[model samples]
Structure formats: structure tokens, C-alpha cells
Target: MQKKPFTELGLSPELLKAVAKMGFEEASPIQSETIPQLLTGADVVGLSQTGSGKTAAFAIPAIERVDGNLRAPQVLILCPTRELAMQVAEEVAKLAFFKRGVRELPIYGGQSYDRQLRGLRDGAQIIIGTPGRVMDHLERKTLRLDQVGMIILDEADRMLDMGFRDDIETILGQAPAERQTVFFSATMPPAINQLVKKYTKEPVNVRIQAQEMTVPAIDQSYYEVDRRSKLEVLCRLIDLQDIKYGIIFCATKMMVDELSDHLKARGYSSDKLHGDISQSMRERVVAKFRKRGFEFLVATDVAARGLDVDDIEVVFNYDLPQDAEDYVHRIGRTGRAGRSGRAVTFVAGREIWKMQQIIRFTKGKVRRERVPSAEEVEQKRTSEFLENLRETLEKGEYKRQDTVIDQLLDQGYSATDIASALIHLLGGDKPAAQPIVEEQPRREYPNYQSREYPKYESRKSSPRETEARAPREHRESREPREAAARKEFHAPAERREKPSRSPRREPSAASHEEGMVRLVFNVGNAHQIEPGDFVGVIAGVTRLPKEVVGRIEILDRESLVDVSDECADQVLKKLNGIKFKGRRLNVNIAR
Candidate 1:
């Protein structure tokens, strides 16, 4: 089972060219298994973690199936968050770059409605949006789904977790029933199953089981500093090191552009690579970088994915990656083909904890390094300059230029003075006198040094003091109370005739014994529902504390959940007809 290229996925030549330009040579495991099925108009369920190339897997097929001449949106992609919606839309747009009349619009919240209206009115063939915003447009009649031929639920589990199940169902129900549905989720809970069962028909399940990534042999280290001083430190390091070709990874597109511009302003050959740049520009920048046209390439994680260059000497983490796995990929850009490379990550004071998590994730392979001081940089530069001069002298190249020195000597310049001036000129300015900003280590607030609040101090009580503190009204005569207790005890022993100990009470689903009931809902493991989903929904709708919701048992086709007797009626009333991860809840007391 060999993997194929995007060209073998039955995509149009236009799309194949776009994919190739995007630097994808071989299909990812998910893409290899899914693209073929999706191209054949089959439903698909892609179970993979984030960054597993699932976006291209579905986007390519959807784009390939699009009828460019149609003005209405033929494909709808639902994401959990606005960020994801925008990212997906970017990918879709990139894949549809060469496809004429294949306009795509990202419909999400926090944007101008008038803008979305204009885009929709102007005719976009593809719509990528969050469930809520998409539902809003649907309700307002601004977005029509009658022509939607394909529906994709990206990060479906996250959408459900965000309580978008009802909205997703409403949107899906409105779409053409003959439409192809594709779902991608990191985990398949029972609720997700119910959604699939109700929506898709015989979907091809492509599960790329999670595997531990093997980190490359790059020397990974980080230095903590304040956010404001990162640029200065970066410049200092760039000035000190002999970086042939390197990448400075940023978290956002703006940061990438800003860092790139800053480096360029400092007279270093650098360029930015990010999603916002056009396809041609991206290709040009990548081409230049591969040819060593620039010393530094500042790029975001998404933009740098398809970057294939082997001679990258260093990778600087200008911003810590939000995803732990991205850290591996960023550093992996270097240290390829038996070449040992260095990955230097710049961490802000607050990001130290995140850096530690990355270290632990990499099994402590990521070490910490002290930030180089101005003196250190100067010393290293001088030593390197002297070494290069000595090497040049050993090569006897100075003999060919001895005449120039002799000419200078004839001009009344002493040989020693000429040699000193050359060394001084070649050594460059003794790194600026500016003091290097010290590393900003993670520091706790002074007040948090002692968490023991004085108000919560414990008090020790003596026996006499405790007895004296008893209320006089409730106190009884000691002698009389003892005599009455003995009489009652003796009478009980005679009457009981060695009565057995009280029966132990078994724990039930409901925390309370009296007026407690177990309820059955029409959802279970067969529906791919998990207890957490039920708990989240019930607690969310009923305003009941999660702790009060009793044990949940998910069976084949139904679930038995316990609720407090007081809120049982309210829970059923609120949850009835309410969908949890796309399935309506038909909750009733157990028989």
C-alpha cells in the first residue's frame, strides 16, 4: 500500500498544479486514504489529530467537485472556531487558486455583516464558517443551502464541545439530503457517532491512530526574555552567528511580517512567508530561500509547512508555537541529511511554562541556554575574525596582496600600524555599547510568596476550654444523664435479644436515597456518546452542578443516567428536543 501524489487523487490539473506548488509531493496517510474515496463521492470520517493534513484531504476533493459556473455555494465547511474557519478558508482559496469562478468566502462571527452580505450577494461557490454564524445567515435567509452538494464537519468533536450541535444539525438538515458529508474529529465520542448515523451513509472511516512523533537530532534550547526585548536579542544573535540560511518561526502572520521587515531594515536579507501572501509571492520567496538568497526566512507555522530545504542552518522560535507538535516540525526544518543544526527558541517570561511542557513532551531533550551578553558576542566575533585571518595567512593568499601593504608602508605608514588598522577595520565596531537586556525568568508576585492567609489560621482547643464553651441552655446534669443512658442501654439489650447490626446502604446512581430516580436517554455508546457529553449538556441546560449529576451508564442504544429527584423534571423538560452533539435527547425516568 504505497502512498500516491495529489495528481493520482483524480483532481483536476489546475488543482494538481496548485498542490504541487504548495510543496506537497506525497499524500499524507489521511489524504492517501481519504482523497480517493472523497473523489468518488463517498462519505468520509477522518479520525486524526490536528496538523495531520486533514484540511487538504477534504478541501481538494470538495474543490474538485465544485461546479465553478454555479453562483451558489456548493460546498459548506463547518468549523468550531472563527480562527479555524479562516484557516480552512485560506487553504480552500489556495487550492482553488487557478480554478476560475471558484470564489470562497469565510463566514464567521466578529466580522461585518455587511461585508459577509456583499460576499454572499456577489456569489461565492464555497462557504467556510462556524456553526453559529452560518446558522445566523441561514436564519436571515442571507445564506442559501439548497444548492450545497457537500458538507464537511471539521473538528466536529470541538464543535459539539462548544455546544454547536443544534446549530450544526439545523444547518445539515437544511442542506440537500443527497449531499456528501465528511467529518473529521480527533476523538469519536458517542455523540459524534449519533451525528454520523443520522447524517452520513456508510462513510469510509480513515483512522490514523495517534503515534508519538520522533524528534530530529537538532540541538533544541530556549532562552527566556521579556517580550519587548526579543527583537534586540534576535538582532544580537544574528550579528554574532554566521547563519548561512535560517528560519525565524512566528506564531501569527503579522508577527512573521513584522519580524521579517525588522530584519530587512537592519540590512539583513530576509523575507516573510505566511498565508496572507499570494501564491506567486510565496513561491518566489521559497525559491529565493532555497537558493540562499536570504539569510533569514520569517514564517508562520502554516506557511512554513510545505517549505522543503535541506541546508537550513538554524531555526529561531521568535514566538513559541501554540501546538507542541509544531515545535518538533519547526526545529526539524534544520538538522536534516546527517547535518547537526541548532534550534534556538525565544520564550517570554509567561511562556516559560509552555516551554517546559514542550521539553517534557520531547522527553527533556530541549535544554536551556544562557542568553549571550554583549561582551560575549564581541569576544566571539573577534576570535572568529582572528581565526579567519590566520587561516587566510596560512593559505598564502596574503602574499599576493603584500604589494598593497608595501605601498601603504611607502606612504609613511608603519607596517605595524597598517596591520593594526586592517585588523580594526575587519573586526567591525566593538558591538555597540548598549547593555544587553537580561533574560526575564518566570517570576512570581511578591505577595504570592506566602500563601498562608492569617484569616485562615487554625486554633487549638483545650478540653476544659471546649467544655466551658458549650451552651449553658443545652447542657445537662452529668450524673442524671449517665444514669438515664445506662437504663436505656440495658433495656434495649434485653428487648433486642442480640439484634443484628443495621444493613449497609449500597451506593446508587442518584446521590440521594429518597425521591431519587434513574432516567434513560435515547443515546449510548452505540451512538458514540460519552458520559462527559451528557454531563456537560445536563449541567449546562439545567444549571445543576456537575457533581450532583449521578453515574451514567452508556449501553448499546440507550443511556441510563441519574438525576436528583428535585431537578429530574426540570432536566427532562429542558433537555427534551434539545440535541447533544446532533442527536435529540428523549429523556424519561427508567422503567
Candidate 2:
């Protein structure tokens, strides 16, 4: 039997138009089953994974039910993290866009209370926030829930894991008894069931199985690596794969900070997310990541919970999670909405057992990959340099630079030497490896590093001894800035006279061009869409050459293709009408 579209599911015309504009043609499995019941004003408990379109499942129906003229908080959504709260608020705002007098506000810690209060005063009909900040507002009597018609608990499992049940119950008790309650979680433990029984009055139960939770298109794998060599392997893997956007999961706040700093130092556009960072900083980091300003984000489990950014091509587990469930959540960030994604993990020594435990708990398999060798890293670098060099040569923008190369050759420099110099100028140096230190072994864990502390009888020291313990390097004199500058630039005038003629190419058709459209399809290599797939589709459907198809970005959920002004209309018409991978393509010009 053919399934009904969202338009046939009793959605308002404005909502259906908004969904169509957002590029959703049909409802997801969970949405198809849940939205009708919720629209009827019944309590609902939805079990699904991250990126399962749960936000819209509840948000659309809630927005439809909201009485825009009331100008009071009619809907309340509780998320596990501030980031998720903001994301939910954004989605709700989109659904309520065409609906007049409807407004949604996101309230969370690290944001100025005055700003939120001002928004509330101006009349925000829906509120999405974290438990602590919501509780704060409730205590101050700034936020009233006496008339709230609907309440939603998003990621309820995560909230319980974070120990927010008390706050949740307190807030729930403040709402009207007749209000509709909605609980959505990835997993339902006994405690979650208990909460459902306590708050909901015979709610409609919806459970999407765990296997169905993950997108089957995602390709998951792991590598066995030594602890000391993990960073090296990660750099090598990043070099080898053509990753669009990826998230690296760490086990602790300190690890997120350290790993992010190290990746940045190594010239990777990486960001950090952890509990220690301020909420405003967290917002800024996530915004930059979504804007393509950063390609990699190093985050701990707590900071990354409820994050639902799509287009992530890969996920890296820097450190295995203690709880197996977290592993699912970490990788679930990618491979969303029927798109393929890759999940890679690094396991060291005793961590292999933990990996096995995760596999057992999730009923999934992890493919083993060898630690990348230095030779592999060198080969990858060489290949990348050659590709960039070829692009420069073919683009015809370097014609003026030929005179400079001729002059260098006339000065008795070999072509090989000139090429080597150019490579060095373009950041071709290999990264230095860290030194490994050996330590004593422990009994329980044979490979664990053991540190010995001095006995109390032998540890006494005088003030003079303690002072002498400081590193001798710290006592050494430092160089004066003026003297160092003078010494370093002895031939400054001569260097200026014969300046290097390696000017970077300006943005052209090769980089950024006007009147071109960027469209992302929910398919990629995992869906068997290669460069040919992009070229063939555009050239076959529209009157354009395969070469004019600007940068073909292949992500997990979608692939972005740059279409010239001449071919935009025909390309959209053909691609939208055609079906790929047994699903209708959701192609639209990106903002």
C-alpha cells in the first residue's frame, strides 16, 4: 500500500507549504505514526534516534495546535543541552513562520536573562530551554506555565542520565493537569517508563526498533591503535579520506580541550565543545561549524548530547565511551535522513574489550583497520600537492607567473629546485612526531604505565632544595626582541628588492563564482554517487557540460553540486522529478 504524504495527514496548509519549502516531501516513519495522534491532543511517547526527524514530528503538530492570538506560552519543550534547545527553537520557528502572531523563544544558561525577559515581555508563545535555566525562570516568576497547553520532553533518556528528573517533575507539576505531555527518547529504560506512567494518562506508545534507529547507509568501522600513536593515525586518516565535516568524540573535558588545541596547532580547522566552555562560546563554536568555517569539532559526550547538525560525513571516536549507549549517540550524529556516513574509532590495548562490549550491547560490528604508517602519510601529502599543482597549471590564471619561473631558471636554479621551493611555500612540511616515554608495568593491567612516588621517609626537602628543583631551562636568559629582529633580518633590503613572486590566485570560477547555485542531494559514495553520477545527472538532464559542474560536494545525507545560472532550472526540474536509491531526491538551492 502507498503511504500518505504529509499533506494528507491533517496538517494545516501553511504547515504543509513550510514543510515543502524545507524540502521534506513525505513524513518519516515515526512522524507518519505519531503526528496524527498528537494532532488529536493525546499524550505521546516517541522512541527514536538522533536525526530521526523527531523535532518536526512533535513541533509541527504542536505549532498547529497553538492559538496564535493567546500571546502566552502554549507550548514548552525541555532539551538535555542548551545547544539542542536552540536547535529545537529554530525548527519550531520555521514551522510557525507563515502562522501569524506565532513566536518561539529559546531560554538557556549563559544567555543574558534580560534578553530572554525582554523577548517574553514582547510575547513569545513557545519556550524551549534547559532544565536548570527554566527552573531559574520559574523560581523568579518570570516564566509562567499555568496555561501551557502542551509539554515535550526531548531526549528524555539523556535528561535522566544527566540527572534532571527532579527538575523535570517540579516543572511538570507546575503545568495544568489537562495539558498534553510528549516524551521522546532514543532508549527507554525502566526509569523512563516510570516517568511516563507518573505524568502521562495512557499515552500512545511508539517505538522504532534500534536497528531501524540508525540509517543503514552509514558505513561504520574502527581501528586498533596504541594510545601514544592515536593522534598520528587520526591525522593520517583525515588526510586519506575526503571528509566534508566530521566530529571527534573524546572521553573528558580535558581531552576535548587538548585534542582541539593540538589539531589547531597542526593546521586543521577544528573546534572544541566541553562542559567547561561558556554557553555563548558553545553557541559561537556550533554556529561556525555549521557555517563551514570549521570542518572538525572535538567534543565530549556531555557537551555533544542532543546536537542534531546534519551533513556530517564522518564521526571519529577518539576515546571509547564508558557506557555503550553513548557510542550509539556519538555516531548517530552522522548518516542522518537516509544518507550514508562513516564512523571510525581508535581502540588501544585494553580498550579492545570495551569495544567488544559496545558491539555486544548495540548488536553492531566494528571493522578493524591497521594504524596508518608514516609512509602512508607522506604518500597522501604528495598526492594532495600534485593535485593542487595540477589545478594551478590547468586554471590558466598562472600565465603571468611563468616570467618569474623563467627568471629563476636563468639564475641557474633547476626546475626541480623551483618546484621544491613552491611546495615548501604551500605548507608541504611533515609534522614532527612526539617522543614516547617508557614506564614501569602494573600487575592488574600488564601494559598500564606505572609511576612511583618517593617514600615519606625519603621525601623531606629544605626550602633551598625545593628552589633548586626548578628546571634549569627556566633560569636561562631570554633573547631581547630588538636584538633578535636585527639578527634575523640582516639582509632585509635585499630580500625586499627580490621578493618571491608566488602570489595566491584570486577567487575565480575555480573557487567562487556568481550566479551559480549549490544543491545538496541526500546521497553520496555510499549511495554510489561518484563524480560521474554528478556529471552524468547534470549533463544528461540539462544543456551543460560535465566540466561546468562546479565542486561536487558528497556528504552523508546529501551531495552538493554547483550549477551554473544557465542550467539551474532544468537541473532542478530533472533531479527533483527523478527518484534515486528508491527515494525522491530533496534538492534545493542552499542559502
Candidate 3:
């Protein structure tokens, strides 16, 4: 069969043009197979792995069917995580780029609900969000699905794994029963199959089997390093390799900003892109990066689809992507248009297992390499400086300086001394050596050539030995069976071990409560810590139920939360030294 182009899919002109601009001339397998079925008003089940273009398959058809004039949600897509929700929303936006009056909103946890409420009030035709956040809006009566023409469960398996089954079912039940349901999952376990049977009516199942991710031209490698040394190692790699231009993929917006700022502070030209950056700012950053105004652009996966630059020589995975397919996407940024590229990933302890999974899924070779040492970095920089000097001398561009050099030489300055002085003047300052922590030495145990077991020996105990081993005084002091049972039932150890605290109470607005002590956390409004987030962290850290946390009071940069006096000390201990959203939480009991 002849290879098909996107035109054959019968997509709208606007969507087709958007696809073309996105550098997609032909429909991917999932898109080609599912879009037509969806357009025909059939409930569809898409079985595809990450990076299989499942987003477009659903997004294109959804955009096509959505009534642009509708001020309410015409489509609702549920994702398992905020990042994935943002990604799906971005793709939907791109596909509808040329379609006027089409609006998409992404709602997820950890973000201010006020922003999401504003978007909802503004009439977004397409709503994409994580299950928890979507449920939150639904509970608050801020989001409605009455007019939703289609419902999509993107990464359905992931949502289920994250314990969103009840939330998803509730949301789906709230939607119009006549609305078309489309589900996409990498695997169809019995739970997912049951969900499909219950929700979808005669769904068309489209399974796009996994294919090997083969980008032979790209050299893939990883280096094992501690979290603290990652920055130092990254800088050394960049300097030692003399990387001209590159994209560094961080996992979160905070990481992107932090890494970008750190790189800039280290005197490297760098910028950042993430969901938090406005579209105009993002466009500006991308434009500058394309023009080589910056040597590095740190970004999260949210910005992955928008990056189309082909001259990127390297893709540094400052943090591994959450999805295995994203690994392919991150590295695929390089080695474009048949040009060789390099992908270097930094793996922390135990993260190697995750990387191994990626290797297996992609069937790609990722060679392990050692991080460049301080001495090696210095040597490489020195060599580069000498080479640059050699090039400058060959170009003969220092004619004006020759007069001063000759005058010094006439005063008995040797040519070597003059060159040394010039080298000292022109060479860039070397970076301070990063402190290295030594690994513990491995101990080797002596190997025995032969195993020696003591010869088996048996002896019979005499009647006198048995009598001597008996506890005569304890036997005489023993009580009758009923008395012994009563005494054991009233054991002091049991009484002491019984919990004295009452059941955990829900956090309230009140500042004080009976039998509870309030604790202060050194992060509040400034850090964007919401009551729910605070409760989540408290529960997560202390293993206490949310109901146990009482009376949360958020101050300018601190928060006071009341907990049972019995567990206040324990809560304080667990909250200490923990970080949330990149800020340390210095938790202590309120005086």
C-alpha cells in the first residue's frame, strides 16, 4: 500500500495545517487508525505506548467535533498527572491553533484553583485535567460536563494505578450518558477492561503495538553521579566537550528555572521554558535559542513538543522523564535531519533501574560512562585555550600588540615569556575544583578452599540433668489456670501500649481546638502552600490521616496546623528537614 499522508484522514484545514507546521506530514499509526473511528461517533479504545501520537489521535477528532461556539466544555480529557495533562492540553492547543474561538484549559493539583476557576468561567470548550483536580472542581460546582460531547481517559492505566478509579468513575458518571467515551491505555488489565465494558458502548479497540525506537545516529550514554554533584558533573561535561548548543530536559518547572539560573550564574548563556512561562515569553526564549543567543535552554517535558530546533548538538537529561516513551522523545530532539547527536543522562542511585526499563522499552543501547574528573576538565579547558591561541596567532590579528611585544623584547623579554604573558592575559579563568566525596572501599573476605563442618555429635541427657534444668521456685509460685488468665488479661504492658489519642480530626479554620497543639511550618502563602497541599504533606510525612490534622492557619510565610497533642512531637519530627516545591519546611511546635 502507498504510504498515506495526513490529507487522507479528512482532517479540517486548520488541523492539517497545524500538523504540517508541527513537522508531521503523515498520520502516525494511532492517529490514522483512531481519528476516523472517532469522527464516525464510535467509542474507541486506543492501546498505544507513550510517544505513539495518541494525543493527536484523540485531540484531532475531539477538536473537529467540538462546537467552537459553545462556551462550555465540549470535551473532557483526564490524565493521571499534571505534567501529562499539560502536555495533552498543549497538543490540543496546537491542533486548534488556527481554529478561532476554540479554547483549551488544563486543571491539575498543586496549582491554584483560582486560576482554573477563572479559565472555567471564561468558557473553555475543551477541559483537560488530572482526576483529583477535576473532581475538586466538580465538588465545588465550578466545572460541569453537561455539554461534553466526548470524554477521553488518556493514560487510563496510569490513572488507575494512581488510585483514581473512584474519582474517574464519579466524573464519568456525572457526564452526559450519551457522550462518546474514548479510552487510551498502554495495557488492558482486567480493571481497565471492566471499565471499558461498563463505560464504552461497543468501543472500537485500536492497538498500536510497540515498535523499536531506533535512532542509530544518536549516541546514547549515561553517567552515575550523586544528586549533589550533578551540577558540577554537568558543567564539566559541557566544558570538557565544548558543547556548542544543547537542550537540557529537567523534570519540573522548578528544576528548569533552578538549572537555568545556576548555569547562567556559572557564566554560561542559558534560558528556561516551562508551562509557567507565558506563551510570548516562551516564543521569545525559543527564538533566541534558535538564533544561538543562548548555548543552553533548560526545560521540562511540557515544552518538549514546542522544541523544533534541528541544530541542537546535545540533549542532556538533567532528570529522567516520567514516561519511558518520553525518554525516546527527549533524546530524539537531537540527531535530527540525519545529523549525529549525543544524549547524556544523569542517573542517581536506584535511578539506574528506571533507566534500564527505558532501555528495554526502547530497545536502545545506552552505554554507561564515568563522570569527567576535575583534573580532566581542567586539562581539557587548558587544551582548548591553547588551541584558541594557536588559531589567533595563525589569523595574525594582533598587529597593534606587536609594537608593545617588540618594545618588551628590545628590553630583553624572551618570545616565550611574551607568549606566556599573553596567554595569561587572554585565557579564561578556570573554575574552582568541585569537592569530591570518596566512595567507601569494598572489603574482600578470605576465600576458603574447602569447607569444614564440625563432626556431628550426639549425647543423651541424664535424669539428673533434666531435674537440674527445671524451675522449681517458679512452679511453686504459679497461680491456678483461671487466676493466671485474669492476671494476664490485666497486664500493665497492654494498658501502657493502648493509644491515648482520639481519632484524627479534619483540619479546620479555627486557631485552637481541645486536646490539640498547633505546630508552625516555615512555608505558607509565599511558597503557594494550600491547605490541601499542607494536609497532604503532613499526612505523607507523618503517616497520619488528613482528618487528624486540625485548624490550619496560613500566614505570610508560615503556617500553623493543630494536631493531637499526643502526636504533635512526632509530626514535628517527621516534618523537619523535608522540602516542598523546592523550599525547606522548618517545622516546629508552636511555643
For 1-591, candidate 1 gives per-residue lDDT tens digits of 245666677778888876654434456678889999999999999997665567888998999888988889899998776546655665676677678778788776555566679779988888988777787788789999999999999989877876778888898889999999999998999999999999999989999865565688888878776554666678678767766689998765545655575455345689888877899999999998888888889987778986889888899998776445777888989989999998999876435655665665666477777767868766777788889888987887754777887899899999889889878665532223134445432211111111221231144532222222234422221111001011011111211122211223432444344566788899764444555456556755665655557766666567778878888898889889975534667988877
Number of the top candidate by TM-score? 1
TM-score, candidate number 3: 0.48
Scored against the true structure, residue 77 in model 2 reaches a CA lDDT of: 94
TM-score of each: 0.52, 0.43, 0.48
State the TM-score for model 1.
0.52
Pairs of residues at least 3 apart in sequence or in different chains that clash in candidate 2: 521-558
Backbone atom clashes (below 3 Å) for every candidate = 6, 1, 3
Model 3, span 1-591: residue lDDT tens:
122468998888988776654434456677888988999999999997764567888999999988878799899998776546655665676577777778888786555556678778989899988777787688779998899989999889877876778888999899999989999998999999999999999999898777565555689999977554667788889988999799998765556755675565456789988766889999999999899998999987667665899878999998766446568888889988889899999876435555775787877888999877878987887888888878988998765676787899999999999878766655433333364433211100001101222232244532312211334431121111111011011112211122111233444343467888878888765454455455546654565554567777767567778888788788878878966646776987776
Model 3 vs truth, CA RMSD: 22.3
Which residues of candidate 1, in runs, are more than 4 Å off?
214-218, 222-364, 367-379, 387-410, 414-417, 424-591
Ranking by lDDT: 3, 1, 2
Error of 3 at 131 (Å): 3.3
Q: In angstroms, what RMSD does candidate 1 have relative to the true structure?
A: 29.8
Off by over 4 Å in 2: 1-4, 212-591
